[model samples]
Target: MEVLGRDRGSVMSVAASGISATSFASINAAGKVTLWDVRLQHKDCMSVTTDINMLSGAEATDLLLAADMHVAVALAGGAIIAYDLRQQGVLSVYNHTCDNEAFLAGTHPPAEQTTLIADENGAIMPFDLKQCRPTAHLSDRFFGTSTTISATSFGALSNICCGLGFIRPEGEKPLLCAMGMDGSGALYTDPQLTPSGFSLLQESDLVEASGKVLNPPLPISASFLEGYVAIGRANGMYSIAVPVANSTLFEVLAAPGHACNGLSVLEWTRGDRPRLLTCSVCGVVSLWDVMPLVLETPEGDEVIDEDLPSLDVAESVRDAVGQQVSVNCGAVIGDNLLVVGDAMGFITSCLLV
Candidate 1:
């Protein structure tokens, strides 16, 4: 595997453009967003700094690249800013009147136009990209009356809320996955629900591999791959089947001594079977060949679960950067390029064989 490294100064988040796999966008702790052409030796194409005051410790927390050549940045001070990459300036800035900090921002399936912004209070706001304003507040849809309680109570419910992904079933409307801390999660499937209102299809509680209730599993990252959602927690990882009547736990992969902070599905090697890449807070990166539990249907019969396969721990690389620097996030760009971002603001590109 070919490896390349570049230090961009304390990167908070990194995202590759969907239109161009070699193009990447990253936001730093100083509120500076830089666009890079990784194919050209990680050249900086453009840079833009947000207007958030550094004195207030407000920085760009999360970023999302829209298909319209616009990047949406979620700020730590409860604001969302849409920046036009072509113009190299801010398209619009939106404040949701929320006192909590923003955690992550993403788009739902189907249209993939409206930007969903999740905050620390487990509130999600659907912002219209065309109008550059929030269409509705959706805290009640995900967390119910948990938002109306005290900060301590809300904090006990979950640490933060982040948009996982959109699940599209065969004959139903698309549902949005909102994963929170302490294994608190919800799936919203009602089409009539809007920024003005919201509804949910299911709510799930946290459970261990032994089916015991737990307080703080701390789901840090999640990704949807091969009809399943893999949630990386502080303790381990859980794979859940999508579009079910309730949240069905498929399998639990233990992490032992690592706190899973980043996860990405690598579509390499296997034709239809994809590999899972997980990064830990302890500066360890491991690849796993996950054989998901299969289901089968006989002639004119109901579907039943087949034999479950074990998770194989494949190749691993420890401290890809140096000692003790945590790998924050990573993505598999192009065909075989594995790009990882670290706490020290370095991006390492590895060409997997």
Candidate 2:
């Protein structure tokens, strides 16, 4: 795979194809779009200039891995836009502003084209990227009364948030979890109910313990899996797994993960096995073995470093592409490339070879 960075600009968001595994795209602080042809050898593909001026003072917040040639980007101003690479860097698609567009997830089956956006306002807006209009909006009274929305995802089904608004991956139906600013979180399923499936609301939905003031980090971001959810706080990381029954298993501190600026989940190993990766504002990256951890309890949980090689460890490490700074946002590109963007507008591609 090829890693490219403009002379001075840092990338805002990066996304790649989970199917082809050889294509990727990124948007920079300058609002330029760079589409890479990973199938080719050495510095492949050209950079396309997107005249799409970012809303003034807005920064790129999050990115969604959607249809091939199409990438969804969330702006700091709470707006979301889908960029079509086939149109040569044209951000022809746009959506309305809401609470921070922390996460976006698309639908499956008949409505695979539908996408969901979760914001800080505790509102989950479902937008038909194909039709360009919102179809539905769901909000939990408990969440409205308690937490402020943070990160969100559809993979966990609908939108998932930590400390509130944690979206989970797809299943028989959509599931959503909200993390309260106070350190408690609640999980809900089938959000589109008449009275809102209050019975299905997972009891003791509260996650991570919080005091008057949380240490490390608050629930700034979260990542979702089929039955598991990973949350990034100022202090560390936590994972929660919900079973068919009321078997809610969780990790209070899944390793001393960093104060996350942003995070993403990658389904690799031929899509059979998955890994949990967390990126911090300090530019440190950690990859956890979800397989081994599941096979045993925390007391028996194997040390992550002993199980796998640490990518950020070593002397041969290449200095980050642009500057010596923290990576505020990160997304997995295919299975091998990691694209990191920092506050200073510096974006770099790290090879996971």
Query: What's each prediction's TM-score?
Result: 0.70, 0.66
Across 255-325, the per-residue lDDT of candidate 2 in tens digits comes to 55543343332222224546666666666656555555554445323335434322332111125542456
Best by lDDT: 1
Residue ranges of candidate 1 with Cα displaced over 4 Å: 1-8, 54-57, 70-72, 99-112, 136-159, 170-172, 191-216, 236-238, 241-243, 246-271, 292-319
The Cα local distance difference test for each model comes to 0.52, 0.47
- Name the weakest run of 10 consecutive residues (lDDT summed) in model 2: 194-203
Q: How does candidate 1 fare on TM-score?
A: 0.70
